[model samples]
Target: MREAEEFVDITLLFGEGHVKCHKVIFMILAGRSDYFHRMFLTSMVESALNEVPIEEISASTGVLLVDYLYTGRIKLTTRNAQDLLVASEMLLLGALKQNIEEFLCEQIESSNCISLLNFARM
Candidate 1:
């Protein structure tokens, strides 16, 4: 079989900054799909989701992710999950995007919240 076409001008987020590259196309592990040509962006997103590990997933992130993946929107309730903030930051999930650094900093400032602090550390 002939090799699949590689991507160019690929830009992926690296923390708060973005990384520009021309050789990361193959790094995107797209799965079996017949709609590739029609839904290129969706295909890539699914591939990216697959790259995330469940072990790294937080308590209610699955729920948040489900909502976003299905509706393109989500409202995070503090009751939904707290530890999820870290996972959200790591996954770049919108549930805990804004002021995450501040929250993480606050958690780290106190030693009693060591578990939460540890969670954010990862």
Candidate 2:
């Protein structure tokens, strides 16, 4: 779906980057995320816009989120996991946020535990 980019109805803009995706994907994600439900299902301004500006997360992270919604898979790395977590929180995706938190916890070591704690606090 990402490769084909067919029947895509929404373009999420993030800073200088953007992600093109289908509204059906958002409709499915609406069941799992209240934020998506409100933004795409209700009579909100975003529901009527073809291009929605997303200031919360980077376009890279947005791609991951959309891919996860489409494929139910994501390759979470230490570099991108933090941003994904923040994005999931903002999107009200509890399961995704928990998955990221668990992944981060599994990666914690004495060397990085304090830093991880501080990051979590933020």
Report the lDDT tens digits of candidate 2 across residue range 1-122: 65688788788887678888887777788887899899888899999898999877887888888788877889999999999998999989899899999999999999999989999889
Residue 111 alpha-carbon offset, candidate 2, angstroms: 1.5
Please report, as a residue range, the 10-residue window in candidate 1 with the lowest summed lDDT. Answer: 29-38
Kindly report which residue stretches of model 1 are placed more than 4 angstroms away from their true locations once superposed: 1-52, 94-96, 99-122
| Cα deviation of 81, candidate 2, in Å | 1.0
Best by lDDT: 2
Error of 1 at 114 (Å): 12
How well is each residue in 15-61 modelled by candidate 1, as lDDT tens digits?
33333333333232112212222234554553443232244554256
Q: Give candidate 1's error at residue 69 in angstroms.
A: 3.0
**Colliding pairs, model 1:** none
Q: Give me the candidate number with maximum TM-score.
A: 2
